[model samples]
Target: MEEQSVVLVVDDVKTNVLIMRQCLKEMFQVWTADSGEECLRVAKQKPDIILLDVLMPGMDGYQVCRQLKADPETAEIPIIFVTAKDSDDDEQKGLEIGAVDYITKPIRPAIVRARVSTHIQLKQHSDKLKFMALHDQLTGLYNRHFLAERAAQSLSAMVRHQQELSIVMLDLDHFKKINDFNGHHIGDLVLQAVAKLLQDCFRKEDVVARMGGEEFVILMECGLDIAREKTEDVRQQLARLNPMGLEVTGSFGVVTANPQNAELSHLLVLADEAVYKAKADGRNCVVCYQDGAYLTVEHD
Candidate 1:
């Protein structure tokens, strides 16, 4: 099924909102905000496109556009100013504040629809390109480059708030045997399946990434106890995945993020150590880093 793109229409006038809704409803899911404050709040829903009206009471469209552009979360959402001011100067100001296009008042349905459709298509293309750059093509998991960036940002916030953070480094045990006995095509399918299951095992806030061949990592917001339990859960799930009668199991190494030593590289090193320990203890197990030691956790 094709995903429905959302269009946020912000106007003080109810008639304007109704008109735009009527014009665009066939092509997009329409949402409305009658004032600037409501527009800012609704924008957090991450609409695919926004049709904003200038001259709203207190906060104008230009001001609202500036705020949206300033926020990293909402900065990329396409905005178009639809207002009564037709002067070139007014249009220039709208574009200057990050409005993608400007449409004067006395709305023409065809023109509004055409402009909105063009901008929405452009935004969709931009998002697809960004996803290709940040994600792994084979497994649809995040690539290592994006992983480092996200890990750094997440760690910074965790440290500032003194919240617990954990990293789980996982490797498919005896994965080479499967690739050698079967073929790369079968191996690829196994990797994809593992990636999907790992993603399902964690919360949305957690970061799951394909580090490289047969390796994955999860950055989650929890301490040792919860991390260990989750790691074991993943291990048991992988063991149950017998693709083509081939036994599948993964070794996991987990480490909590220490605020004083919270660098991504440092965390990876600790997690790696724990994973190696799991391997030494005869694969298909979980090891956790605690109090400067990597200790194997007995399965629950």
Candidate 2:
């Protein structure tokens, strides 16, 4: 899961807080705060949505909202100002201060549930769409465009964290022959099957993407040994996949980030070169890219 959506209820009144808790508990993980100060404290926990009371003892909902918007960690969390102060000015002020929606009290349970559910769903779908936009539709893997984006992000994160990053490029063996002999329908099935196998073999956090025309790439947070093992695992698993009686095998090229200079393009080029080298050496093998050269693994 990307991020869990929690609903934070902020109100000084205990009964009103109880009512909201009863209403929203089944649908969301609910957190409660009695005052604006408490709300800020809870906000640090990073709830997905906030149901804040407009009139508090010291800091009002508007001020709470202002503080929330000001903080980078809590800024993305949607806030809904819940209060009895129902005026055009009140609503406008809430909106102006970055409340995504406003709801008036004497609260309706149905409306609260509906609004919360709707907003959470919207956010989830929006995130998914953003994800899909950068990923391949056919293989449900990251597309080439996202490959570059993710690779860049990964490289930066690696630099900041001083962590090892590995890139692997894979190309389907004799994919054109499969298409010609088995027809495009079976070819598609083979591609899908291989994609599923790749997904199954890799960790959930690993970024796997279809790089168009029977080529795919994986970005893993790992050292050289782990990268080599995982790439070999994928290659072996794919080799065993005889889809619809059609022979299916793949070539893998892996490159690990070096301490000296680990640019995203350098990793990509290294992986790509290793993949082609695997093909040239005779398919169904794994190649490791290290210090500007390819190391090929021979099959027994």
Number of the top-ranking candidate, with TM-score as the measure: 1
Model 2, span 142-247: residue lDDT tens: 7888878877888888888998999889999899999998799988888888888888999988988898999988999998789998888778888888977878
* Model 1 agreement with the true structure over 113-208: per-residue lDDT tens digits: 899989999998998999989999999999999999988888898878988889999999999988998999999999999998998888888899
How far is 23's C-alpha from truth in model 1 (Å)?
A: 2.6
- Best-fitting candidate, scored by lDDT: 1
Badly placed stretches (over 4 Å) of model 1 are 71-73
For candidate 1, the C-alpha RMSD (Å) to the true structure equals: 2.1
Worst 10 residues of 2 by lDDT: 258-267
In order, candidate lDDTs are: 0.91, 0.88
Model 1 reaches what TM-score against the true structure? 0.91
